[model samples]
Target: MSLTKAQIVENIQNETGLTKIKATDTVETLLEIIKSSLADGENVLVSGFGKFCVKAKQQRKGRNPATGEEMMLDERRVVTFKCSGKLREKIN
Candidate 1:
């Protein structure tokens, strides 16, 4: 099962003795910072965690699976994550 934001906030509240509101605010602020950084095309690196990068993709040709029709996909930026070696080792 995947962990949700509420679970994270609850865990933080339990572990740190913080109130629900404070824990939720902390999580929200942290997420906002990460989102803004990525939107600005700046990579965010957290030691012992991972790195979040903004990657750019050029316009490309794509096909619609439903109709098998060829279409052009517009260029866009995407966020990618690379876990730290320590995190990868721990997961393994």
Candidate 2:
């Protein structure tokens, strides 16, 4: 199962002895900063964690699975993530 934000807040509280409210606030703030940075088309690199990059895609053709209809998708930007070498080694 995936870990939820509440679990993260609990972990932070357990590890750092911070109140639940404080932990939640900290986690939310960090996430907001990361999101804003990515929306601004800036990469975010946390030394031991990973790098988050924004990638741009050209307009493309796509098919709707249910209807089997072809469609043209608008150009868009997406976020990509790459694990740091240290993180990859640690996980393995």
Error of 1 at 37 (Å): 0.5
**Which residue pairs clash within candidate 2?**
none
Residue 59 miss distance in model 2 (angstroms): 0.4
Expressed as tens digits, the lDDT of each residue in 1-92 for candidate 1 is 99999999999999999999999999999999999999999999999999999999999999999999999999999999999999999999
Model 2 ranges with Cα > 4 A deviation:
none
The C-alpha TM-scores of every prediction are 0.98, 0.96
Quote model 1's TM-score: 0.98
Flag regions of model 1 displaced more than 4 Å. none
Q: Output the number of the TM-score-best candidate.
A: 1
lDDT of 2: 0.98
